[model samples]
Target: MSANDTAAANTGSDERADFLQALGQHRHFLRFATRDLTDEQAGQRTTASELCLGGLVKHVTSVERGWAGFMAEGPSAMPDFTAMTEADFAKRVDEFKMLPGETLAGVLDAYEKVAAATDELVASLPDLGAAHPLPKAPWFDGDAKWSARRVLMHIIAETAQHAGHADIIRESLDGAKTMG
Candidate 1:
């Protein structure tokens, strides 16, 4: 390969590795946020909001799955948020709540599995530049689009933001701390 080609290849590998590293760091913090919490504790809404450690894990997993699906399939693959009924909205709301019989351990295990699958998908992606139109939503611009790489970065940001939220919830639960 020419020098320019070799530089471009290294850049891609580095970018991909950076994305994985960022995602993994937040994922670790999330696990730490739930550490030592029992099933009931994990489900408790310690904060004013509905967020909980187990719930955060569930939401993050769902977010990752949705975005990864968009990357793999296209915008057409995303759920029609606009068409959701009251029942559908209620179900989405409940997705972030750790219901009865749901164990923190179970949620954490599933989160780990999702993280592994996401890492595999990112590593195996053929072209990060593959583009797709954004789904129709109030928050999305009508003309907006994103590349697969942008989707990965979005996941990183989403996980990191939720990790912070989880830290606060965990702290409120029992004075536990995930980070300084």
Candidate 2:
């Protein structure tokens, strides 16, 4: 290959590696770093907030789906669960209604679905710099817009943060340290 071709290949390689690293680093925390507990164990409200392992999984699923809709479908296409559902508010509730014999398996399935869909959206995006307005919601100060890149990184950050929370909750559950 010519020098220019080699340089382009190197840049492509680096970008691909960086994207994978970002996905893996956050996903590692999202999965094992904040998990491995029974429903009862996960349900324990260690804090005044209802933040728990299961709840974090649910929250992230909702957020990830919301971001996917924003980046892939535009803000007008959907509503953030946080905004649409008002009957239950003023607490970080598990909100996810699981059926009988429902293991963490269900939570994992939902999160994986969202992650896969979101990953595809990120990969196919023509430009990470592409911007879309944030859905109108109560949490913000004013009308806001987010770039496709920001949404992807935000998922990474949000999941990582909650993974930390899950770490604490999991630790509190059985005096266990992280596997990761």
Candidate 3:
């Protein structure tokens, strides 16, 4: 193969590995965000605007759907949250702050289901260079559309941001050190 072909091949491999690694870290943080916390503690919110462990679990599900749901629909992308509104969204997050008598197992089960769906979404799209016609980012204006690669990257960035929230919440719950 020519040098150009070799470079292309290497880039392809790197993209694949990078996607997997990024998604894996998101999933890992999901679990770590709950470590050593009792059910009540995991459900505690640091403030009115914050996410509890359960909320992060649900938001991750929401984001996975948003980023990967309409790979074929492009510009029409944005997940079929057909009737969901910002209030509904906040409600989902609030649900994580369990009521008087909810169990950790219940929360874990919800997260596991969401994670399974997320893994499938990631697996379904192995190539990032693939293009879709989603509206361009605000910075790029509507002139440019996002590619499959950007979609995946968007997910990575989204999850990493929330994972930081999870880490702080987890630490507050159990006094777990910031690092292992």
Candidate 4:
């Protein structure tokens, strides 16, 4: 390759690494949100909303897994929410709660595993610009599509938003703050 081509390649490579690092930084914030809290403490619903630190961990894990799966496969790979049974819907709601049989350690461990898988998927993609049709959603415009890089960016936003919520909830629980 010519020097110009090599420079372009290096720029693309650096951009990819920067995206992964940015995502990891937010992931660390989420982890910090749960630090030094017991399972009971993590599960405490200090806020009026049902969000808890441990539950945020679980939800972020599931969110990353779902998006990464879509990026790897396609929109059709996602679940058909309209067809979900009442029981399935209830279980989905419960997924945001650190219910019995769940522990902070277990939830964080699962989040870490999902993060590793997501990073691996991102790094191994041959082309992040590949596009896929979006799933049907009221919030999404008609006939919308997103590239693999867009999906990763969405995951970063989702994770960061929840990390902020987790921080607020953590503060309410024990006056602990993820940020100074």
Best by lDDT: 4
User: Once superposed on the true structure, which residue ranges of model 4 sit more than 4 Å away at CA?
Assistant: 1-10
What would the per-residue lDDT of candidate 2 be over residues 100-178, giving only the tens digit for each residue? 4655667788888888887777677788778887777677445688887777788778877877887776777777766
List the candidate numbers ranked by TM-score, top first.
1, 4, 2, 3
On residues 1-180, what C-alpha lDDT tens digit does candidate 4 reach at each position? 999879978778666787899999999999998999999998889978988889889988988998899999988877766567899778878778999989999999999999999899998988999988887666677589999999989999998999899889988988988977
* Model 1 spans with C-alpha error above 4 angstroms: 1-10
Number of clashes found in candidate 1: 0
At residue 95, candidate 3 shows an lDDT of: 55
- Compared with the true structure, all predictions reach lDDT values of 0.87, 0.70, 0.67, 0.89
Cα RMSD of all models vs. native, in order, equals 2.8, 3.8, 4.5, 2.8
Is candidate 1 or 2 superior in TM-score? 1
Runs of candidate 3 with Cα error greater than 4 angstroms are 1-11, 47-49, 72-103, 135-144, 178-180
Sort order, lDDT high to low:
4, 1, 2, 3
Candidate 4: give its CA RMSD in angstroms.
2.8
Per-candidate TM equals 0.92, 0.78, 0.70, 0.91
Q: Which pairs of residues clash in candidate 2, taking residues 3 or more apart in a chain or in different chains?
A: none
lDDT of 1 by residue, 52-160 (tens): 8888999898889889889888888787777778997897787799988888888888888888888888898899999899887778987899998999989999999
